[model samples]
Target: MSFVPIICGKRDWDVEYAQSQEYNAIYCPNCHNYKVRPVKRREFITIWFIPVMPFFWGKQLVCPICNWRQDFKSDEQLKKVLREQDNIRAGKVGG
Candidate 1:
């Protein structure tokens, strides 16, 4: 699949990221239910000089047939956006 990056957190942008992927079930201890736990998948990548370049991609699984979900952004997409932004800022291309 083609990757695309998007911002997620509001005030949590003061950190760095690494290229990676993750998968697991989201178990809720408060509910004490197994099915209440859904699956989760994600990816992330970091850039050297920009906090805005941190890309995160993922999707939370609820049900297969239901199509209820939360999707995340990929690192490649983030890198691309940052690169494009940098290029534009540098006057390397047209607006």
Candidate 2:
């Protein structure tokens, strides 16, 4: 498989062009069930802090279909998603 490029600091190329893959998501927002997502050009850019010492930052995606929605980060989104289930442990952010 080809490598999916991930960057930090600044990117030279336009983000739109760099994203070779189309990320698709259909949310039954009413039912709270989201459809399987397509392969996204993923990256981890950080800007916040909230304990756990090692859990911040995430997947950044430009939604293909719902281009209307805000571009969401994978890390922040996942944190909000899996706030509970304490027993599990993981390395710090950027690990």
- Winning candidate number (lDDT): 1
lDDT of 2 at 83: 36
| Tens digits of lDDT, candidate 2, 1-95 | 89965433421111332222222233422334444232323333333321222232323333444432333455445344333212222434343
Error of 2 at 64 (Å): 2.2
Kindly give the stretch of ten consecutive residues in candidate 2 with the minimal lDDT sum. Answer: 10-19
Query: How does residue 89 of candidate 2 score in lDDT?
Result: 29
Regions of candidate 1 where Cα sits further than 4 Å from its true position: 1-72
Q: Report the C-alpha lDDT of model 1 over 1-95, residue by residue, as the tens digit.
A: 89776544422221223423222223223443323213344333433433443344443334334344443356465445446645765789875
TM-score of 2: 0.21
The global C-alpha lDDT for each of the candidates, from Candidate 1 onward, is 0.40, 0.33
Which regions of candidate 2 deviate over 4 angstroms? Answer: 1-59, 73-76, 81-95
